[model samples]
Target chain A: MRIVLHIWRQKNGRSSGKMVRYELPDINSHMSFLEMLDVLNERLIEKGEDPVAFDHDCREGICGMCGFVINGTAHGPVRGTTVCQLHMRHFQDGEELYLEPWRAKAFPVIKDLMVDRGAFDRIIAAGGYVSVSTGSAPDGNAIPIPKDNAELSMDAAACIACGACVAACPNASAALFTAAKISHLALLPQGEPERHQRSLRMVAQANTEGFGACSNVGECEAVCPKKITLENIARMFRDYIGASWTRRPAGASRG
Target chain B: MASTFQRTLRFYEATIGKKALIAVTGAILVLYVVGHMIGNLQIYLGREALNAYAHKLHDLGPLLWLVRGFLLLAVVVHIVASIQLWLMNRAARPSRYVRQSWVKATFASRTMIVTGPILAAFIVYHVLHLTVGRFHPGFNHELDVYHNVVAGFRNVPTSVAYIVAMALLGYHVSHGAWSMFQSAGLHHPRYMPIVQKAAVALAIALFVGNISIPISILAGFIR
Candidate 1:
């Protein structure tokens, strides 16, 4: 199948980018989106032209390193699949595709389709963790968690931080990502000690990073490759509001 | 004073804080609208009941001013916070999408930015026309509340504007009420559908109740 591609190209973060057109005369329907791109790069390399630079690792789609907007939808027209796993068969022959990097203030474009998602790392580092002493692994049966709670925690934990939520959101809000992390930890007993502080710090960190506020648009949940629900955002709001009123000052009253 | 000022600044700095402010102010406005609707519905009870209700409100003297002052503050805060949030959102995405699609957003949710400012403008016109007797030539400033309402709605242009504004207000409130629950951290999966339905119901009720007044006058039913 032949496809016409309009891809955004840039030399660096400071450079202004534009959509450059390319035509692929031969594309296999079975090839993944990333594989198709790899074929394009190989042809570009043979002609002594600059190849498109996009981030990818573990093409199975678990690493969350691969993504770009394809024809306006994140991870392509297919739902609950990352770019790395998206197959070329889904698209029609002689299709014209538009490719662009995830556009957000926090995630600046590095080169071509690559973007700096270090803001996500900083947000996770803020509170997306459980504090435990260095020791042998705890016995699984010792802390008996309810079946429903365990499943709920796992559901929220499925977020891969692909930045699709931020890209798809009209406001470029990171509420879905931050809320998934907060809800995942806050749901478990092991994450109880610092749950309040976690919600408070993570949300504050997200705001500090210049992400927009969530207005319950639910676009994030729609574009998420992992199918993460918007309920996590609501949970995060519940936790943050609960913490803000009850969490004490550093040297204030104990109660 | 400086510390208090800093604390207030810090409160508005967080995105969640700004959302909470919008939700609270939205709730205040919703309550006022519902109360106003019920009071105005007394117009069905004939001229005496409706005018007597207005007279009772006016007789409260300074209390009436206090309530109006609080409502004015709520409106100002709601508008300012909403505008700041919108601007921040715009700055976050400097580059617009060549193509865009909405997954779960409704027309009401997407049009809030447009409907909000229009509603604000309508409020000014409404207050000037009915409350202050400044805009409408038929407005009675001699404490004839019933005469003022009936005469104001008797104008064709004014009635049309009122109907249109009420429709926009309904759309605004429908989205606002549903989203306010999420913003205020009251979301529950089991109850969310019910809450959304209630929001839609409230919006429709307000639209019907408010528009009915002008419609009734235009039809000679309220005379």
Candidate 2:
């Protein structure tokens, strides 16, 4: 199968990028999208040309390290599948594929199809974790969490911080990512102590990162490789609103 | 330690806070629209019944103004929050997608900005045309509400504009009615499907009900 790729290319973060075309006439249908890209890169290297740059740590898709917009979709056209797992068989012969990085103020393009998603790290740092004292790992059974809560928590925990939600969102909002983080913790007893503050701080951090507001658009859920739902976003909204009403000023009287 | 007022100010600064304001104000506006549509429906009950209903409303006097004042506040907040969030949303993506395509967003969901301003402009024209008689072709200042409505819809262009605006409102409400829940964090899996269904029904009902008047008038059924 022959595949024509119009891949965005850039020297660095500061340089302007453009779509550069690459034709691969001997492509195999069974090869993963990334594998095909590798073949193209090998050919480019043999010809002494610069290879297309992209991010990929684990081809298994669990690492959440690899992604770029494949023809406008965050993780290509296949739902719930990352670019690393997308097979060439899913596409037709001689298909033209347009690849570009996630376009968001919070996720600036680094080189070619790679973008800096450091804003997600800053959001996580704000309040994505429970403040447990450093010690041995606690027994999971001791928490006595409800079965539904545990399942919901795990569902929200599936987010990989891939920036796909922001990439796919019309407003480039990080609400889905921040919401998943907030919901993942807010559902359990271990996270109860700092739930309100967690929502407040993380949401504030996401805002500071210049992510847009969530308008109930389900584009994020549709393109998310992890299948994260909009329910997490709703949960974030619920928790944030609760925090606004109950949160107190720092050093305020406890009484 | 931040002051309580300062905390409140900070809360309003976040996108969620602004969205919550939009949701609350949107709810108020939705209620007003439903009530107004029901009131307008009285026109079909004949001139006396409709005119008497208008008289009864005006009879509230100070109480009416109070409601009006509250609705005005809702409108102001809804508009302000919408503009602020819209600007922030635009700035969030400085670079546009080269070939982006929406997957799950409905037409109504994507066109809120377009529908919203058109509705706002329609509201202004509506108020001036009927309430103050500024744009009414044959507005009666004698508190003859029935005559005013009939006269207003008598103009073919005015009736067409009214129909178009109602269609836009339908589109706006279709997304907004259910979307307000998500914004308010009131969305629950158990109730969301119901809310979405109700939103569609409400949007269609409002469009049909509101436009029925103009269409009927143009057809010489209400003259």
Candidate 3:
């Protein structure tokens, strides 16, 4: 099958970018999207041209390492599938696709289709951790948790931190990503001690990172590989509001 | 010790806090518009009833001023929060996509800013034309709201503007009503569909109720 690609090319963060077109005449429908890109890169290297740059590891979708906008939708057109797991079979012959990096002030471009998602790391570092006593593994049923709460917590924990939510949001808001992290902890009993502070600090960190506030457009939920719901966002809001009005944390007071 | 006012200031500093303010003020405004539309629908009762309703409102005296004052505050805060967030949202994305397509976002959801400012402007003009009688050439100095409304809608351009503004208001409220619940963390999966449908229904009711006056007057049914 033949495919036409219009991919954004940027040498570095400070450099300007533009769409560069290439045609792949020999492409297999069975290959994953990233594998097809590898074939294109091989041809580019054979022709003595600079190969396209993108981040990927563990070609499985679980890594959350590979993604880029394809024809306007993040992680390609397949719902709940990462670009690394998105097979070429989804596309028709003689199709034209546009690929671009995640465009957000928080996620700067490192190279062609490669963005620095260090902002996500910084947000996680802010308060995505729970404090626990270091000891041997406890019994699984030691902590009495409601079944519904456990399931909901696991749902929120399914977030892979891929930055697709940020990429897909019209305002470039990281609300979904931040909300997922906050909701994951807010639900479990182990995450109780610092629940309020977690919401406060993590949200503050996200704000300082210059992400847009969520207007609840919900583009993020639609493109999320984990199928995280907007319910997580609502939970984040509940936590944040409760924290802001009730608790006078020392760190937040400094602001 | 930080004062309560200081704590409130600190709360308003975050984006969520600002959004909360927007939601609260938006709720006040939404309630006011709904009540205002219901009151206006009394024009079908003829001149004396509508004029008496206007007189009774004016007779509220200080209470009327108090309500007006609170509404003014709501409007100011709502616009300020919206503008600040709008600027931040724009700054968050310095460069837009070369080719973008909408997936789940509705036209009403995407064009809030556009519809918002126009609605604000329409509010000012609407007040001048109807309330203050400043823009009305057939101004009646007395509390003859029925005459004022009929005379106002008699002008072709004025009626057209009112129709257009009502349509935009419907679009704005359809997105905003549902959005307020989300912003306030008041949404639940079970009740969300009801909230969404209610928003649309309110928008439609406001549009039809408000615009029906102009249409009735222009069609010689209200005269």
Candidate 4:
């Protein structure tokens, strides 16, 4: 198969970027998108030209490190599959593909296709965890969780922090990513103690990171690799609103 | 005192806070639209009934002014917050997509940014034409309420503009009403579909009810 690629190339974060074209005449149908990129980089290296720099690790798609917009759809045209897992067979022969990095104020382009997603880490650090004492692992049977609750928590927990939701959203909102984290923790008994505080902190951190507001467009859910639902965003909103009202002012009277 | 003010400012600065403001203010405006439609529907009941209703509303004195003031505030807040959100959304994505695709968003949701400003402009024209009798030559201030409405809609261009504005209003309210729930953090999976359906119904009802007046006059049914 022949593929014409117009890849975004940049020297650094401050450098101006442009789409540079390359032609690959013998692409295998069975090769993954990242593997196809590997072939292109090898060819570029042999030609003494700079190779496109994109982030990837654990090509199995679980690490969430691999992503770049292919033809404007996050993780390619197929839904619920990461870029690393997207095979070349899905595309037609003699296809012209337009590749670009995830565009967002928070996610600045580092090199060619790589963008800084550290803002997600900061949001998670804000309160994406439950506080527990350092001790031996708790007995699984000791704290019995409802079956439905456990499944719901696991479902929300499937988010890979890939930044696809932010990438696909027209507003560049991180509501889906932040909400997945909030809902995952809030659904469990262990995460109940600091639920209000977590919601408030995480939401405030996300806003501070320069993300836009969610308008219920559902684009995030559509492009989500894990198929995370927009319901988590609603749940996060519910928690955030509740927290705002019940949260006490510093040094205010407890009575 | 300063700290309290700062706290309030910070609350509104957050995206969620701004969204909640839009939702609450949007709800107020929706209520006013629905009430206005019901009141205007009395035009079908003949001149005495509709004009008597209008006079009765005016007879409320300061209470009427209070309601009007609140509605004015709501409209201002809703528009300001929405514009700010639109600008922020644009700033977030400095680079536009070369090939964009829509998956879940409807035409109404996508066109809100366009329809919103148009509706705002239409409101200005509507007020000038009907309320102040400034835009339309046929507008008569001394005439009864029913007579003023019928005479205003009797003009071809004015009636067409009114009908077009009402259609845009229908599109705006359809998405706005559904989105207000999510904005207000009132979205639940089981009930969201119901909310969306109700939004569509309300939008259709408002469109039909409001457009009926101008259509009736143009068809000589209201006269």
Error of 4 at A9 (Å): 1.4
Q: How many clashing pairs in candidate 2?
A: 0
At residue B85, candidate 3 shows an lDDT of 93
Against the reference, the lDDT scores of all candidates come to: 0.90, 0.91, 0.92, 0.90
Residues B1-223 of candidate 1: C-alpha lDDT, one tens digit per residue: 2254665566677778788899999999999999999999999998899889988999999999999999999999999999999999988888877767776778898888899999999999888888899867777777788899998989999899999999999999998998898998888889998989999999999999999999999999989
Candidate 2 chain A minimal-lDDT segment of 10 residues: A246-255
Off by over 4 Å in 2: A253-255, B1-3
Q: Indicate whether candidate 1 or candidate 2 has the larger TM-score.
A: 2
Two-way lDDT contest, 1 vs 2, winner? 2
Q: Write the per-residue lDDT of candidate 4 for residues B92-187, one digit (tens) a residue.
A: 888877667777778888888898899999988887877788766766676478888998899888899999999999999999998988877777
TM-score of 4: 0.95
Winner on TM-score (3 vs 4): 3
Clashing pairs in 3: none
Q: What order do candidates take by DockQ, descending?
A: 2, 3, 4, 1
Scored by lDDT, the top model is: 3
Docking class of 3: medium
lDDT of 4 by residue, A1-255 (tens): 999999989899998899999999999999999999999999999999999999999999788999989988889999999999999999999999999899999899999999999999999999999989999998878988899889989999999999999999999999999999999999999999889989899999988888888888888999899999988888898888777766666677462
Tell how far residue A78 is off in model 3, in angstroms.
1.4
lDDT of 3 by residue, B45-123 (tens): 8788889999999999999999999999999999999999999999999989987977788899899899999999999
Query: What is the Å distance of residue B67 in model 2 from its true position?
Result: 1.3
